[model samples]
Each structure stands twice: as structure tokens, then as C-alpha cells.
Target: MNQTDTPDKSDLSSISQAAGKDNACGTNSGTHLSRRGFLKRSATASAGILIVPSFVVSGLGHTAPSDRLNIAGVGVGGRGFSVLQAMENDANIVALCDVDWRYAQRCFDHFPNARKYWDWRVMYEEMLNDIDAVVVATSDHTHAAVAAYAMSLGKHVYVEKPLTHTVYESRLLTRLAAEYRVATQMGNQGASDEGVNLMVEWIRNGEIGEVTHVEAFTDRPIWPQGINTPKDAMPVPDTLNWDLFIGPARMRPYHEIYTPWNFRGFWDFGTGALGDMACHIVHPAFKALELGYPDRVQGSSTLLLQDSAPMAQKVALFYPQRDSSFGRLPAVRLDWYDGGLQPLRPEGWPDGRNMNHRGGGVLFHGTKDTLVCGCYGADPWLLSGRVPSVPQHERRVATNHQLDWIRACKESPDSRTETKSAFHEAGPFNETVVMGVLAVRLQALNKELHWDGENMRFTNISADEELTIIMEEGFSITDGRPSFSRPRTEPINAQAFAEGLIRTQYRSGWSLPPMPA
Candidate 1:
């Protein structure tokens, strides 16, 4: 909750390191860094990196194209560790932040120069000037909060796929990125693939006459789902910071079922299979075809659970043909099949050919040809082994995901320097994909939910009730903004919540000293 504007300029020498302690719940002295002494000089005393007042990069010392960025990371375990690893060639990891120490010990030991912390907020507060960028690899629900906080202070952010837990958070973060003009990238490596451009060229060249349908599939939810919520609470692990692990999520009792990875199955913690893999599986078609919002979306699934995703589910999305720079295209249907569900193989596809070449694939049915590719949009090819003369007109890159973002963070934006999956691109893609997931959530209501993506709400069903943003009281993104002190919209009373599904219960977690009544 110690959110505010970032210091105008950074002086790494002014920063002091905190003494080491094994683990603390973050209530008393051992909980965080020495905040008051983090920066020795007044914020106004230094000359900032930018001539312009805002939308500035944070690394004061590293200015050249070759200088390494002072990057900090939250959730530096699982996927987070790899993301940071990929950028190691260009980043000086100034700090490593994660809630689970046992899982994070590898990364901690790897980057001995980095100071470790249990909470991202404390890390950001104390190491404000030292970090030029933030890489967030937390759970789906916590993605937007951590990314938004870092971006608010003018740090470039690279968040893992799907962008945010809820549609609202995704939209808000998109706006924030544009407002801040900081380099932003969502973790969809396919956006950087040479194959994506190849596929786009094929579609644009009309080798595939006006793409009419898309069948995307993934065999996900390999984890537990469509099950009863665990009733028994377990003792919190000594190495895990339970409160910080919860982040902005509504507090729940410690349970093995929710941590060390399985959270993807839970509605509150992960995006199930759709959120987990669809960003990669569905992205090529989405980007090549320039799909924005869907006209409407609906779904069918095995018994839907309030606490977890269905064991198997399929979301069907309808999109009216929208004008694009390529050309006018016909209306299209994008069907997402997950939990091993798959669309009927298109009739024109050759007999004996596998519908899904890999565990996941995308099929674009066009009037002239059908294009297919694997999960990362790798090795795209037309049906019947037909290879059209696709002269490579689009720019090509070799494994440019993390490298592209790293470049964007330091260089000025131009044709070759822009991050391919910049928030604007990734936000809408995730928004459209998430709509299908949203449809699946209404299995009980069993009705097509028409979305108004521009308005960030549902038009027909008034699903605004479901769109409310809840957070632990002190954690609201609006925490430090005095202007929003009064409720602008009708305040929501939280019954409970999770990430990727609900507004986290935005109003809990505080042990503040008493104030004058």
C-alpha cells in the first residue's frame, strides 16, 4: 500500500541492503527492507533519464544499447525463473521476490547478487530506484496487480501470458501501459515466432481465402479440476510466506491443493486449461486473423465447479468479420476445445492426418486452403502438403520473445524495436480468449453472454455483478490515489473470491497501529 510516483532518477549507490533473516510473516521488523533509508537523496535533486516528464525508463546507469537493465522479478520460481533466465544475457537481476522460499531457493542461489524478498510490494518500495524493469511470473490472479504496480512507477513490465486474472484487470492494465508508455510485453512467445509471420502472410495472400472458421484445441487441465473444494486446512509451510503468497487474493486457509503448482486447477488461483495454454495455442490464429472482441461466446462442459474449472470443457466464440489492414474477411467462428475436447476435423483435411499434430494445434479453415500449426504456432503448413510461394514479406526473428522485450525496455520505439506482444496486442487477444472462458463460467445459467469489450462489461446479461474488483483492503490499485477515496461506483460487498474469475477481495489484510477516532 506504499504506492506512489517513482523517484525521478536513481542512484544505486544510495541503496542499502537489509540484514538476512530466514523467514518472517511480514508483520514486524524482520518482515521487509529498510524503506526510510532506501534512497539517500530527495527525489527532486536528481536529473532523470528522460527529457520528457513521464513514460520514462528506470535504469539510470545503463543507457547504452549494450548496457544491462537492472531488472527485478516477482514470483521467481516455476515459469518466472525461466523468464528471468531467458533475459539473463541482458538483465542485471537486482532483486528476486517470491513468496515460496523452498521453490525459489534455486533462483536465489543462482543470482547471489540479488537481494531476496517474500513480498513484491516491499521489494518495489525499498528497491524503487534500483530496478529499471519488473518481470512478473506469479499466478494468474496476481499478474495484473504486480504488473500494474511496477508499471505505475514507470518500470517496463513483462508479465506471463493472459495478462490478468479478470477481464477488467486486463483492460485496466492495457490502459495503464498506454498511459505510462512503458515497454510492456505479455508472455506469449508465439508472437515472436517466424511462423506467425509466415501464417499471416499465407492468410493475407489469400492462399487461404477469407478465413471462415478456426478450431483450436489443447489437452490441458492435466491437473485436478471438476472436483470438490478441499475442506481441511493444513499448517502453512515454514518456508512459505502465506500472506504474501495470497497476494491480492481473498485469504483462504493453507492447503496443499492450492500451492506448489496445483493452483491452476482452482478458479481463484489459475485460469484452468484455457488460461494456462490457450494463450499459446490460440494466439497464432488470433493474431494472424486480427481478431479483436468476439460477437458473443458460449460453452458446454462436464459438471462446472464453483471452486474449480470443469474436467473437460469447450467454448465456442463467434466473431463478425471486422475490417483489418489486410483486407475484408468473412465472419468467423473460433472454437476452443480443451481438457482433451477437440473440434471435428475439417472435411478438407486429408484422411489419416492427425487433427492435432501435437498435444495442441490450431486449424484455420479458409475457402482456398486450411493452415495448421502447433502450440507455439511453430511449423505452419497448408493442408495436402501444399506449399504456396509465400515470399517472406514480414519481418523475421529467431527466438525473439524475451530478447524483444529486453530490447524494447531500453530502446526507443520504432518499427523494429517495438515489443511484438505489447500490451495493446496481448490485452485484446487475452480479452477475446478470456471471453470464451467467461462463457464457460456460466454453465449453470447456460446462456450465450454477449460482451461489450469496449465498455469492459457484458451488455445483455448485466454480468457486472460478476465483474466486481475485490482485493485485500490495503492492496487496491487505488490504494495511494487520494482522488478515489470516495466510492465512484456502487461499492461491492465481497462474499469471497479468486484470481482470473473474480475481483480479489480487495479489502482485507492490515495490522495498522490505532488512529485517532
Candidate 2:
């Protein structure tokens, strides 16, 4: 992990006028202060030599820090840029931080007045006093690291979906949020959608009858997968800080094939299709049926790559019977498909009708009727074409996902609003999502793998069974195509292998804070 990134000197031109300008929080704009400068300022204020702004002390007639949050964005490129834009109306944009300045230039241009930093750690250190919340939209591998550090400092965090790269990190972040007692939300915007609420309400009203099984599918992996690691070393771009992008993952040579949007296909950086889409597609099933954790998980995929996810895969998660408010819900099975796969279409379904025009959907096979919805739980309906009218019991949010989080951050202690995908819920839910990823990685077990959710391990596995997988790898380009390798076996420990993947190892200088005692 490289920690040598410094602030852009060109962005410091506004430091002289920072104190004169008023921000949305009704406080003076903040400048990037060095450690010595920050300490001196703190000492001066403590000695009562600094004049405090009226609004900082009280709201009076203006919006105070109490009314609006001072928000900073860590990966203000791509999705992070959009998240910050959505939040700009409600919060003060105090700072913008990103590892790659070239990619994040659009955000920098858009929020010109906001302080900019190349590294998030420096941003946090310099602007800790000014920032009230952080929006983290970094690669999946670093989500936990960035958010955990922010939460440790009592900063509210909104992280992008597929919360963490590993199941253990999900559990860690969830617990840390509670220990810190700060408002936190995962960036699964669909969780706050009207569609998810409707799906939950319909299921609660028993409109779907008893959901015997559920199937969710998506046409993801828009990026390349089922391939070997790129051996072609490329020069790191001048505008990018390559080490920061790698974060906690082991350092690898820079390659265009691994960056921008393509990281989703890689194992070390992203969680492939399951992690990319399940959080959106399977959310309704989890919410509507209260699918907490699966007792058993199994998967099969196309040739498992050396350093990336397969091109396509299918995973089955078996849940045991659990008591619910209505009664003991029957044990259910959820089958997930990605990379252009779909479940056997429902019987008697019209061929002319598309399953989901959006290329992804969820199907709840109830004893009486089959309920289905598109991506993000949109347009939920029954296959019988007779959707029942259920009284809406779920709270509806008029604001978008980002604003909902902002609203929660501004909530007074007397009345706190929990964001739809608050970490307490999103964390456990993410553990389930990444478990599917784990099953994909360990498909070599070649049997239905038993999962002990409470213990966070796979039970019923024997050491007698060798853990080597037969992989047909393509490492070189031959005649304009990838040359293939014959099936080869590599030995591995089935039990320890599963455990190691569950809890990812961090490179030095990038460790998660220990769970609070």
C-alpha cells in the first residue's frame, strides 16, 4: 500500500478565501490544513482566541452543521461521482478524493471549490474536523478498508454495493457500525426502491402463497472472464496512483485489462457476477422471504480461471425452516444464474413475453402462484396475470437512495431514521451474497457444500478428498486466439482453503480495525 500521495498544489489556490465563503452547512468553507497547521488551529480555538461562527454554534435562521452534513467522496469517479451529485443538494461537498486524478477529473471539475486529495487517508487526516460523512465508491476489495477507517473516526459512511470482498469483512463492518454508533448505509440503491417495499408487502400479505423456491438471473459479466491473468506488464498511467487502487490486495503489475470497469471479472479486486448483480436481483427475495443465511451452498461454472471468475455460473443455496411472524416458513431454495443463463421458464409461460425486458429478474415459485419482478424489484407481478392488491405496510421513501442516507445522517437523536440498506441489515445480506461467490470459487469441492453460517465455515467436509481442481487454462495468444492448456491438477486443503477465502488476507499497512470488545 503506497501512502506517499500528496495533495494537488493547483487545488490550493482557494485556501486564502476558504474562510470567507459560506457552504451549505452555513459554515465557512474549509481548506486543507497540514498536521502542524491543524494542531495550531485546534490549540488556538481551545484557548478561545478563535472567533466561532454563529451558525456553527446554533442554527438561528440559517442551516447549521446540525441541519446539513458535510460530505466527502473517496472514489469520485464513475458511480462515486453520481452518488456525490445526488447528495450535493442536501449536504455540503467538503472534499473529493480519488486514487486516479485523470479518471476523477470530471468530478473535480464539477466540484471545483471542494478540496481534493489523491489519497483518502490524507483526506481524512486533513479534513477530519470538516467532514461529517463519507461516500465510498471504491473497488469492492477496498470498500471495507475505506469505510472501516471512516467509521472508526465516527464518520457516517455510504459504501457501494457488494459491501466487502469477503464474508468476514462484511461481518466486521456491520459490527463496527454498531460499535461506533454512526449512521451507515450500503450503496444498494434498489433496497430503498418502491418495488422492494411492494415485494415485501405482497409476500407478507400471503399473495405469493408459500414461496417454495426462488430463482434469480442476470446477464452480467459484460466484462471478460474465464481467462488467465494478464502477463503483459503495462506502464502505470501518470494520472493514476496504482498502489492506492490495489489497496489491501497484493500488489500486481498495472494492466489495462484489470482496471476502469473490468475489475468486476477479477477475483482479487471484485466479486464477479454474483457479487455484482445478486445484491440487486436477490434483494427482493431476501427481504420478502427473510432469507437470512443458507445452510448449504453449491455451484458449477465454466472453466474456473486462474485469477478471474468464470464466464457463467449457477449457484444453489438451501435454507432450513425458520420461524417467522406468520408461522414457521418452510425450508426454501434460491437458485442464482448469471452470464446469460436463465432458469427453466415457468410452465405455460408465453414465448412472446420476455422474462424481464431488463435481462434480469426474480421468480418466486409459490404453491398457488408464481410471483416475479425485474431488476431492482421493478414491476412485480404474478405469472397468472392476477396481481392481488395488498395494503401497503412498508414505509415509502420519496427521496432517492443518496438523499435517504443524508436524511438519516441529519436525524436527531430523539428520532433516528434508518436507511433502507443500513449496514446492520446490508452486512448480513452481503455475507449471503459473497457466500455465493465463495461457492463459485470452491466449486472444485464437486459436491453440495454444507455451510455453517453461525460458525462461518463449511461443515461436513473431509480431508480425505483432495482439493485440487482440474483447470483448462489459456495463458498465451496463438493465431489470434487464446491457446488452451490441458486439464491439470493442483493440490489444496479443502477446509483451510475455504476458511482462507472467507477471511481475505490484507497486504501490510491495510488491515481492518479489530472488532470492538
Candidate 3:
């Protein structure tokens, strides 16, 4: 990773000055830091980490574990609680923030000294200067907003995966981390697994020859989806901030389906099965294959619903040839199966061996042999032989994932504290996974969606223009060119497509922090 990428003036100019829409929590009283000139100041403030990390108390030669960071937590419920537990031992956790106090209370109890807030915007505003780092483990939709604001405050961030709800948001965070020179780590723990490095070594050493295809699957959607919204609104629980829970998504009446662990199935609120699990299954495949973006993507599902994801869906993405030591690699096709779906059993497996364990697994089919492993890249081995001996190049994590990021924030930069899943790699890897989410959304059309990764536009938008795609519900994409003049390359404006999907529109007062141009 490049340690230097100062934000340009133009990037600063684009960030809106309007108080963000989500800062509605009334208790959010604190000094308002100026977003303008913020980037320049952050670059300078980062240098202060070396001078005095506030909480830093060093003895001879190096800082002790007791001299740790003052970190803040957003979404301290469920998985958010787990992340807090993982890092609390090493850091001075200063604040706990969550939308629902009921679910977030356990974490609050764990850290009696920590301040509490339901709105993360409030927490950041009230304690901006005091915090050395931020940890975001919110639902998929709000991840960008919270982390973006935290990074803007010059705090190192560790975001849970899949990093963002949209490809555009992932790209923004990737660029922002580098520009701020803030250490970042995505919460896909397997990126730090020694087994993942072993897999990378085997693939690079051609133990599996050239991988032509990969089939990864998970039995998720253990939540409700492909369903209608509640016909009537439920009374908002006094302990929950329904508006903040909805965050930047367009508002709707509060319902049980949208909260308390079921939100993963909703389109507006969560990222369904694909978003919830693929980041884990695809983590090692991404790093080992050196995948950036798929050249083409398509999907098929039971059906896509307006308010929720399909009951089941499978997406196939093709990544074309790229350079490798194995010489020119052929197009690698990856297929994702979900919601109790499983891929066809591979060839060359021993007569009675199971292809995968119960939860899910990833299989790499190469010309010479096949490799498989459980999720989070665990227990990887050859189909019927001892693990191949290959030289390892990537460094293994010394303690665990979360501690690595925590230590990297204060511990020596030259040491083993550097995280393997830093945003530079995780951002692009996650952007790749969310593409599958988009494909699953379009699966009802039963069409192959062509992607122009460089332009970040769906090349096949023209196909939809040329053919009438009618939904069973009633809406129709009619067969005709767009009224506005298209691009010269038989094109549509990339910026226009970007505005709606790659990054979505924030509700009235909310805006994502802009990245340097």
C-alpha cells in the first residue's frame, strides 16, 4: 500500500456543508469540525500519532500494551458486540453507539466507563478529538456513512464486511483511507488466516494448475425475504430510534422484519444473503486469484421483490484473463449459490467424499486438480492428497485479526502489526462481492449482464433498452433507446449510472464524504 495520497482541493469542494440527515439525535452536542480543509489537517494530524497518541505511555524503546488507543464502536449489538469484545482488551474503548439500546445494552454493560449514544454521528461529533480510532460494524447500508465520517475525523477505521452496500461506496472508502494515511482493516478475518496464505501459495505454485472455475456456496437467508412490508406500522419501541435505524434509506414504518437481526433480508435496509455471506466465502478466492473486477456478471433467482431479496438466487461472474506466473491465465468463471442452493458436484473427488461441509464452502477447479475449503478459508486441502508443499510469501498474523488492526494503530508500523485485510485490498474485494448483489437483483430478467469494470457502467443497459423486459408484478422496461442522446460509443453517460446504483442517493440531508479527485 501507498502511504501517501493527500486529498485535492476539488474533492474537498464537493462534500456538502448541510448538516448530514442522520445527525438527528438531539443529544448530539459537540464542537462541529469543519469538513473544509479537513483533509489537509488530517494528513498533519496523522503525524501526531507518532508524537503523542494521547493515551500513549511508553517505557524504554516501545509502548506497552497498556498504552493503547481510545476507540469508539458503532452498532454495538450482535456482530457489533463481538467486534467490541475482540478489541476491548487491547484498547481504551471510549464510547458505545447503537440504534437500539435494548440490543446494544450488553456492550454498554461490558464497558462501564464508555460513553453511550444511539446515533454514531452524535458520538463522533461529541468526542472527535479524543478518539484515536473507530470501529464500525453496522448493517450494510450504514457502514459507509459511519466509517466515512470517522475516517474524515482522522481516526483509523475497522469496518465489517461486505464493506459497503454499493460498489461506489467501497471505491470511495478505499481512496479515502489512502488519502488520510489512516490504517484500515475490513472485518473479513480470513484475510489474516495462515491457511489462506497456504492456498495462495498452492495456486501461485500451480499445484492446482490454472484455475478455470470456482463454485462457492452458502446456505444463508436464515431470515425472511421475498415478502411484503407489514401492512400497518408497528408502534416504535421506546428504546429504539426507528429513524436512525433506517438511517439514509428512504423512510418506512418500523417493522420487526427490519430490525433485531432480521434486517439482512431487506433491500433498503440490509444486503440479503449475498451481502451477508459472500464477503467471507470470497475473501481468499479474491486475494489468491488477484481478482479486481468481473468483466461480465449475470444471475437467476426465484424472483426479485421490491422490498426484499429473492428467496433464493445464484449469480455467475466471469473474470477474464490476467497476468500471472503461470503465463496468460484463461477467463475464470465464479458461481455463487445461496439459500440452500449448492453447485453441481465437481469431478475427480474420491467416490464418497463430500464436496462441502454443512454451512458452506469454496471449491477451486483447475486443469490438474481441485481444491476446497470451509468458509473463512479454513481447513483447505487437496481432494485426495496431502497438502501441497509450496513456499509461503505472505506474512501470517501473530495474534488474531482485530488485535492486528488495533496494534497497527499504535504499535510499530514496521512490525508484524500490519493488517492483511486493509481497505486497499478489502475495498476492491468487497466491491467485487457486491457486484453479485446487483446481479441477483437483476436475475429476474434472466439475462447475462455485461460489465465495463473500468467505466463502472453496466454495458448491457443497452440490451434492456433494445428489449422489453416485463415483470410479473406489472412494471415494464420497454424496448426503445433512452430519449436523451446516448454516448458516442453507443453509450450511456457513466456519471448518470454512477449516481443511482454504483453509489445511491442519500436522503435529503445526508451525503457521503467525498474522496479526493
Candidate 4:
């Protein structure tokens, strides 16, 4: 993974382009009626100058223009497309933007009335006054920049999971959401699920006693990782704007390996298996246990790579005891696994039965009993084969993640209903999740790195701590026997390396927008 000490200082204001020059599509009439125009006409009709249909005035059969949000979607080719589809019933899908038009064509076809654009900046430039909210599902590296710009405009935003690429970016978005007072939600769909709420209720009610340890695992990296960067550049797709796709990260030649879903494995573009899945898998634990931050973390992996994450990794995060209104909470340990790794099966599980419903699940070993939950915290059950029933504590919301955010967006700012995974909460949860990423990346440090969450620093190790980094061979069958290799070692300042990864440097012309005054 590449790390930079100082970020580029240039701001987005410096990147300018002509608006209305490259719009891909618009209304069927060949003339655009902006939201401002609709409001003006509605105002005129109220004065008896025009007669509006009863349905339009009362929103009996259709939503009134005044009652619907004009929403825009960025990176609408994949996950964003699904989000917009969910919001269509509640809001007006007014605009769609993506770097690759071919990839986003399906979304555009579904909402033919929504204007299309290759660049989000241009979409915002042309329709800033018309938009009420934004749905951002851009690549991990660009989530911060996109969400920050939207929040700065005071537009409610729904962003996809992992929340952000780096710890610094997650922290920045959390602050921006509050500063702008925008209703914000991160797309961890399971956060809104009844199963997750039940887990929280059960754990908080002490149905399982105190959770002493947790094992969260996933089968991810469904894409390539633990390999050297592709050396040869591939031709850029005709419909793709490569520069826009690279947003905020250092520019590189276009390659099929880095886009359309494969980016998850690359450090610069994505956050690997942990970031992709942990937001859903660990959310229940974070909520039920009030896991604020881990004081110490350590990790081991199949093989650490320079340009990407390892194929498999096991990370342990240690949290300190805490005092709460109900009582004092004991310190807990969280172990995370990914890339085809899983925790041991509960003792009473059938010999040949699967450990988890799918490739991932969470196991909570408490003082009194053990509980296990499937991915997304679904299908939780105690070791004795019973789903705990506890008093409902968490307020439930719309089961659809995007719809929940839409409800939050429509709320009055002064009395907003917080989304289940609001930025303020998801942001901190994300920081905790990505700390495992940091541990995995710095596995060579081979030290239990102590963290100071509030200060965003490592407390135990000095920046100048020198050490010999060694690479161990991964396990494989060779001629029906074990294999080995002479380990390669290098000397470096380990603590400094760990610190650089906590944050990331932005490429020129791609800084996160500053908070609004």
C-alpha cells in the first residue's frame, strides 16, 4: 500500500469545466423544467390563475411537487442504482451521474426522465439549486470527497458502506454531517434489519451475560488481492471517464483489474474484504456492546502485499472496560477474519453442520452462554438452539436501507429522526472497522499497537521504532507435503509506517470540500 506524509492542498474550486455542454440526456420534451419552475407554477396555481389537478394539489394519487425531494445519484452504475430504485417511490429521481455511462445505462433507462451526466461535479454545477439530497455509492477512495461536497451544500446524503476509505476521511465526514446539519446515512442495509435490533436488545438486556470475546468472519476478497500490481495498462472503456473514476486518488493507467467490482482488493481504490463486509457483519456487535474504539490491535495474514490486501487475515482488537448509565461494561476482545477463514464451530453444533449460514458470521462468547449470528446479524441463536427474546429497546425503521434514509431526509432539521446508521454513528463505527485494516497492513510490525482513539494516535510505539520486517510463507500443499521458503527481511521505522496509513493523501485537484461557514 502507498502512503503519503503530506496531502495535496489544492481545492475542488480550482477544477472547472463548462456546464450544459456534455449532458447525456434529459426530459422527453427536449426542454428541461427545473424544480424552481415547478414551484413557481405551483405558486401561481394557488392564486387561482391556473387550475391544478386535485391529485397534484393534494398528492392523493401522486406526490405533490412540494412534498417530494429532487434527488441526485452519483456513481449510479451499481449499488447506487439499487438505492435510487428504492427511493423512486418516495422522491423524484432528478439526476444520475457516473464515470462510465455504459455501466450506468441500466439506471438511466429505468428513470428516463432523470437527466444523465458523466461527471458529478457538472451535475451539481448545473442542478445545485434543484437538488434536495444525494445518494453516493462511489468507490471507497472517493466516498469522502463526494459526501463532503454534498454535505457542504446542505444536502441530505446517503452514502454506502465502510463509510470511507481511511480513518481521516471517516472522521471528516462525521464532522461535516454535524456541521452542515444534513440528514446523513451510511448504506449498511442490515443496520435497519429487525435481526440486528433483536441482537442489540438481547445483548443489552444481558440475555447472554457479558460478551467476553467476539469472532467476526467473512469470505471476501471475492476479487484479486495478495498479488503484485498489474504492470501492463489496458485500454480504457469508450464510455468511461477514467479521470473522474480516479477522483482523489493518485492517477494511474486504466486497467480492467481496478474497476466495475474488482477495485475492492486494491488499497488505493478500495478497502478490501474487511471494509466491504465488516460494516454489516460487525454493526450488531458495535451497537449491542457499545464498542466505541479498540485500545490495542494486532494481526496476521496469509501474505502481506505492497499494492493490495492479503488473501486472508486474522485481526484481534482489544477494547478497554467502560462505565455506562446502566452499569460498568467489561473489556472485550474482537477477532475478525476474512478471505475464506472462520471461527471454530460452537461445541454443540452438529458434527457435519455448517458453522455459519453462509461464508461469514459472528460468534459471541459471553460469560453465561454463547450466541451466533449470520451475516448482516441475521438468524441469531443461542448455543442451546434458541433465539433469545428480549424487550425491544432499539427503535425500528423502514427495512429498506434507502427508504429509511429518505424518511430521515424528509424530517425537519430542528427535529430530525436519526437514521439507523447515521454518519455520526456509522462514522465512528467505520473507524473501528478500518483499524483492523491498519493492523492487517502492518502485520510485519508484529507488535500489539496501542491506540488512542480520541487523539487518533498510537500510544505505545514511537515513530522512530526501528525493526526488521520479515515475510513468512503462506501454507500450501506441495507434493502432498508442507512447503517452506527462506523469509525475506527488511529494516524500517515500523511505527511511522503505521501512522501514515491511519490517514491518506489526496491527489491534486481532489481535496475534500471544506465545511460550510
> What lDDT does the true structure give each of the candidates?
0.71, 0.78, 0.73, 0.76
TM per model? 0.82, 0.86, 0.82, 0.83
Clashes of 3: 2
Model 1, range 1-517, lDDT digits (tens) per residue?
1111111112111122464422233443334333222222112222233222122434432456787788998888799999999988777988987777678878877887887776665676667777888999988878887877566667889999878777767776777677667788999888788778889888888888878789898878778887766778998765666767776567789988888778888877788889888888888888888888887888888766567788888888888878998877678898888888887876666778776655789989888778889888878988758887866777665557998887777765433256778898898888876677778875444467666667655556642333232121121355565432211223332212213243334424321111111
Residue 391, model 4, lDDT: 77
lDDT of 2 by residue, 348-411 (tens): 6777888864658999999888988998888888888886887887889898988988777765
Model 1 regions lying over 4 Å from their true place: 1-17, 20-25, 28-62, 413-416, 462-505, 509-517
Q: Which stretches of candidate 3 lie over 4 Å from their true place?
A: 1-66, 324-327, 351-353, 411-417, 444-446, 463-499
TM-score, model 3 to reference: 0.82
Top-TM-score candidate index: 2
> If ranked by TM-score, best first, what sequence of candidates would result?
2, 4, 3, 1
lDDT of 3 by residue, 288-307 (tens): 88877898898878756556
Cα displacement (Å) at residue 191, model 4: 0.7
Stronger candidate by TM-score (2 vs 3): 2
Residue 373's lDDT within candidate 3 is 86
Q: Candidate 2: which stretches are off by over 4 Å?
A: 1-66, 463-465, 469-472, 475-483, 486-489
